[model samples]
Target chain A: MESSQNQFSEWLNKQIHSSNSGAFALSPELRATSLSVLDAGVFPNRKNEEWRYTPLREILSQSPVLADKTQINPALIAAFKEAVPNALHLVFVDGEFSNEFSGSISALDKTGLTIEHISTLHGESRKRAEDTIRQSSLSDDNIFQHISLGLSRSGLFIEIQKNHEVDRIVHILHLSTKSESRNFSNPVHVVRVSENSHMQLLEQYASIDAGKALSVPAVYIEVADGAGLDHFKIGLESNQSDHVSNTVVQVASSGVYKSHQYLLGSRLTRANLEVIFSGAGAQASLRGIYLGNADQHLDIRTFMDHAFPHCSSDQHFRGIMNDQSRGVFNGMVLVRRDAQKTDALQSNKNLLLSREARVDTKPQLEIYADDVKCAHGATVGELDKDALFYLQSRGIEKAEAKLMLTRAFAAEITQEIEIETLRSYVQDRISNLLDGVHASNV
Target chain B: MLSIKNLQVSVEDKPILRGLNLEVNPGEIHAIMGPNGSGKSTLAHVLAGREGYRIDGGSAYYKGINLLELAPEIRAREGMFLAFQYPIEIPGVNNTSFLKKALNEIRKHRGEEELDAIDFLDLIKKQMKLVEMKEDLLKRPVNQGFSGGEKKRNEILQMAVLNPLLAILDETDSGLDIDALRIVAGGVNKLRTKDNAFVVITHYQRLLDYIVPDFVHVLSNGQIIKSGNKDLALELEERGYDWLLDKAETRD
Candidate 1:
């Protein structure tokens, strides 16, 4: 494990040295911080509680080659961007931001929203992005976050001004063009919604054809007092692709932060999301569905910190595994000593469609404060037998009945998506995924 | 239209239906009454092709085709319907869409063109009135959170929509009040015709008063021990099933 870890670190060093003139070079201070963390030579393994249930061997065994410029299918991009019909599009192909496909941020100059590429930002803008990155509450041992900070060559810095209600959503599409080698991308996105503001973001990661690549994108979000931010992340990479992402979010007084994730693709995916309430009367609602097929392995970890009083957090995640796929959901809700009147709820349910398919869900609640309400529950089972027989008795074929019940299980989560087009797009993708799953009554 | 000859079934190596037999022609309603634990539900379930039942012997033929060989859905598509005694509450499945899908599948099996959304809605609305079912219940999940009466009414509504050749009501009046029973039986009466038949299974004779049966049979120990006309139900209602059981035992 250590030797494999060294291989990854060595590869990271090579990436930093080879991309001499790449876009979005890390600042000297950021580079030094990342180097110090990497110098510790402490990479997560199965021994690490946070990394348990997820094997890093697949990602660490192979080296990533620098992606070469290639022609991407215009129709593919056109079809993928249809998920969000009316939104500010930000296209990132092979790790670099595509100016041709992206919308003009200049049009939003008077709308009190500042959207800038990390490489183009200078002086105060750069400093603000860096400041937010420094203030991220992610633990120092998260080497992946630091790796993205130090070696990222493509990212964006978005800020919504105080009291501004941004009507348009920021739709970021990470399109991995087909590559001959196993390429890698780690784009760091930093977003700050100022006081009393509201914003929505749709971040999607997908690949062209069955591209073999690794994406370790890191995101930092800050929702100020009275602000609201709806962040949705969808991992729809190809079956040959692998993804690992880190999201750190902080919400201030009376702020609202809602996160919805759909992990429907990729051979292996590990998503770590941490939300910390920094002030009183704040709320956080987290919802996600991880649907896997074949040999896919999807893992989701969430950490909700109720450090302030009068704050509430609720998380509901569902998993559906088919073939030999496996799913893992590990969530922890913490109420600190002074965090009184805190309400937190966490639930995780899983459905195994095949005998080989499996799921491991652990929901943890640690309450140090009195006068708090916290509840958690977890369930893992196959589709309801009675329900299946019921549909079959109604003349729906067994395969179609299984699909309906599976789709309905997912719709329960996708219905929370406020955007009609996006919700439909996600639901359609789920249906397509379920369609390909062999109806084996194992 | 339906024939059962010495049908034998077992559950987990324990015999539930020793040798149940019955026969009914088109346009006739046969009411099967029995005391509890008389294999009433088992016969209904076995006929509907539910799993976990071992068919030890005997044969059930519908239109001269062996009913035991087909899957539950195939049996359903072949114009066989079973209104469950305990309707399964399926969350996330819309009642209207479920019925529509059932109807379309059966139509497809019959080489008939499927109904579009508009036509289906029209047909469903017209049939919904037969059972006095609320329009909102059509939009909700199938039988989820429905009152006992509503579930029974939904079953009748489904029967009305499907128009099966042989409809078996397995204790449809079990949990219904008198008014609900009337509405449900009324729905069945409206859908009756010369081309289809009904098998009304119940524990009490009250339901027979509304949906009068041409034949009444007493099922005991998984076999029809006694068969009589509709008046037999009233006699059983007055004397209870013990008298029939005693007479059958004396004959054995």
Candidate 2:
């Protein structure tokens, strides 16, 4: 395992040194930080309690080449256009932004909203981007973040001006095309919602074909005082793909931050979400749904930190595993000594559809302050036998009954989505996936 | 329309119904009254083909078909309806959609055309009136957060819509208030036809006064000890089950 880590480090170093100079150049500070992290060799293994359920041995052993700039297929573009026609889409192929496939954003630009690529920033704008990244980088122990910073320079930088509300949704589509052997791509994104502004953003990761690839993405968001942001991250990659993502959010006083994540496909996927309440009276709601089948392994870890007084945070995550799939959920809530009147709650529920399916859930609440309300719960069980019988006794066949119960379980989360089109889109995708499973069973 | 001979059932190796026997012809309502733990619910569940029960012996025939040989869903499609004593609450399954699906499945089995959305709405609206159910309850989840009376009324509403050939009401009037009981009984009476039968299982005879059963039977230790007209229900209600148990023990 040590040898494999060394090989990965050496290969990453070589890629950084041999790549084109200007496009992938990193600032001195970021370079130093990345190098120090690489030298620490803190790559997660089964020994790490945070990564005990999901092992990265297979991903680390493979020497994945850095994906080259490739034109996305027109057919794939057409498919996305049909999926979300009204939204403004920004397409990223092989980790680089595509101009031809993106929608026109002139209407949004006139209203003081800036949506541009990070690599295109110059002068003070570039410095501001770097500063945002520096402030949001809470930890340097994450190897994936280091990799994303050191080698990949393609990402989005979105900023909403004060007192402006962006009604249109901004969708960032990350598409990976087929390549020889397994390839790797990393894209970083930064979003800053100014004071008294509101915005909605969606980041979707997908692949064009059934190709072997590994994607590591990083997202940083800051909700300023009295601002609100609704964010969604969707994972719909191929079955042969492996993905790891990190999302960090900071909410100021009186600001509201809401996030919904849907992880529906991939061979092995891991998502780490961290939200920090840095100011009093800030609120955050985090919800996610993950579905796994066959031999897939899915993991979700969340950290909700309450550093100020009179803050509240709630998180609810649900998982459905079938076949030989495995799911893991770890949620931790921390309240500081000065953070009184803090309200935090976390719940994780999992349903195993098959005998071989397994789930591991852990909920931790660490409170150092008095007069705070904190509670958490975790449950793992099979589908309710009585509910199934009720449906069956109503004349529904066994298979159809199972499907209805599964849909009902998922509706608890999907119904929370405020956007109607997106909710229906997700519902359609889930229905298709379950239909495929039924067909295979038959 | 239904006949059972010496039906014996055990749950978890413990016998609940030792030797229950009954016969019901079309166009008749048979009220089976018993004390608590006398196998009233066990008989209803076994007839509905619920699993987890070991059918020790005996047979049940519905319309000359072996009812025990069918799956729970098949039995339902074949016109067997069981109004649960404790209705299960499904959190996310909408009441209207659940009823629509069940109605369509039964229709498909009976060689009838399935109702479209508009027609289904029309039909359900009429049936909902029979049970005095609110229109909003149809939009909510099935039995979720419903009151005891509301759940019982929902069961009768389902029965009215399905119009089954054989309906088994297991303590349908247990938790209902006087008004709810009257509405539920009225709904059941409206659905009763000359070609269908109903088996009302209850511990009290108050429900029989509204539905007016054609026959009443006393179930003691999983066997019918006496069978007579509706006055028999009045006698049992007046004297309770102790007198009947004493008479059966004396005879044995």
Candidate 3:
């Protein structure tokens, strides 16, 4: 494991010194920001609540090598072709952007939106994201501000201009292929939504037979005042993968930020969805659904920070754990001092379909504003026996009845997605998770 | 026909129905009149194969088959019905849908084809009319938000739809007005046939007045002490259970 870590670090250090790493145009500060994060260190085994559930120790012990930055694997390209046919299809293999496979993104080639890799962007194209990440920080210790600040990967950066309405979804597909041996992979992203801009970003993650793929991906969202952004992600990594994806969304004055995540793969997966409502009347809705089946273990933790007055956010997350799989949902809603009229609600409900399956749920609400309304609720229970019997009495077999109730419970989260195409896609994927039944069957 | 030969029912190791015996032949409405604590409801439950009640002695044979060997649902499917004194309130389940499921299960058990959605709706509408219940009531959850009289009428509606071979009415008249009783009794009377029987377990003879019974047996101390024809019910009603108490003591 030490040798693997040393090998991975050595490879990353070489990439930093490589001149082609700066082959594309970049601001001096931007180039430094990319190299500084990698130079900092590999994430420790356990420190933040975000890294709690995933099996990172085993990933670190496997001696993962740095992902090859110069090439794209045919297997990963093939998988993305089948999984996301309608997507604009931006492919990133082993933490490196691939121009050969994703040069002209179909979704980003249209008007009203500007999409480019962080390495290719120059001047205002790159400065805007860094400035938003800097100006949106309410504190010096903000996790996303530092993580995104440290993010060095040359990944997708989407900019939806002020007041521009983008009807098409911008899909970011990150695929990893660690050829011949165990490897460590890290990917980072930054997205900026201009004032009053409306757009949806769909992120998909997958890996194929890439031994010990360690994906520590970070996506940062900057929503300007009065702008609305929808961020949706689907994490379906190969079975031998360890994924740690963190999303940091900051909302400006009266801005609306909505996010939905679905976790169906990764041997051990943990996702942190944090929304900082920094401006007055800014609304943030954090809703997502997760499915854990077989021996897979999935953990989803969410944090909503209400740092401004008159800001409202509501979060509802549900998890379905079957077989011997385990799931965890920890949601915290924090209302800071002076953030009055901050109405935020957080709830997490999980269903453990089998006795062997387990779910640990926690909902915490911390309110410093006396006049604010904040509430949190968490419920962990099994399927209602009477409800099941009632359905069975209607001639629906046990499996079918359980599926119906599970779908109904999960449907609440999917319905909250304003993007119909993404919503339907998630619904179909969830149905397929049960028994490959398409969402249209419902 | 339904026959209870020296049946003993116990709950929590205390015997409630001690060697009680009664018989109901086809084309008969045998009203089992009893005072409180006389195990009147026990007989109804025992006949329906409700759980937690143990049969310590004897046996209950319904249509030549041991009724105790069957589950509650199987017994229900085999044309044996027990109208609960306090019907369970199943929320989130539509009343019409519940009745349709029960009706279809019973029909399938009898080797009859199940009814479709349209036919089931028509079936429920016709049965609902038998008890003079409003059509809207059928749309609500089973027994949820139903008044006492309405709940009882709905039970009778279920009986009419299921068309059981033996119908045991446990305090069916306990919570009903005269009009409601007349409608429920009229529905019961309309379904009476030589191939079917009714075991009306009541606290008072008032219910027997609407659907006049062929025989009346007084249930006291878990056993029948006196038996007579329809005249006995009116006589008992006129003189009250006090008269039967004296007659029971004299017979002892």
Worst 10 residues of 2 chain A by lDDT: A103-112
Per-residue CA lDDT of model 1 for B29-139, tens digit only, reads 999999999999998888888899999999999999999999999988999999989898887778888889989998999899999999999999999999998999998
Predicted structure with the largest lDDT when compared to the true one: 1
**All-Cα superposition RMSD per candidate:** 2.0, 1.8, 6.8
lDDT score at residue B124, model 3, on the 0-100 scale: 78
The residue ranges of model 1 lying beyond 4 angstroms of the native Cα positions read A1-5, A16-26, A439-442
Model 2 spans with C-alpha error above 4 angstroms? A2-7, A81-83, A105-108, A137-140, A440-442
**For model 1, how does the per-residue alpha-carbon lDDT over A222-295 read when each residue is reduced to its tens digit?**
99999999999999999888899999999999999999999999999999999999999999999999999989
Residue clash pairs of candidate 2:
none
lDDT of 2 at A241: 84
How does candidate 1 fare on TM-score?
Answer: 0.96
- Cα lDDT of candidate 2 equals 0.85
Judged by DockQ cut-offs, the docking class of candidate 1 is medium
- Candidate 1 docks with a DockQ of 0.70
The best candidate by DockQ is: 2
Off by over 4 Å in 3: A1-20, A23-42, A46-54, A63-111, A135-154, A175-185, A206-213, A392-403, A415-428, A431-442, B1-252
Give the per-residue lDDT digits (tens) of candidate 2, residues B1-252. 899999999999998888888999999999999888888998998899888999999999999999999988898999989999999999879999999999999999999999999999999999999999999999999999899999999999988888888999999999888999999999998898999999999989999989999999988887888999999999988888899899999998
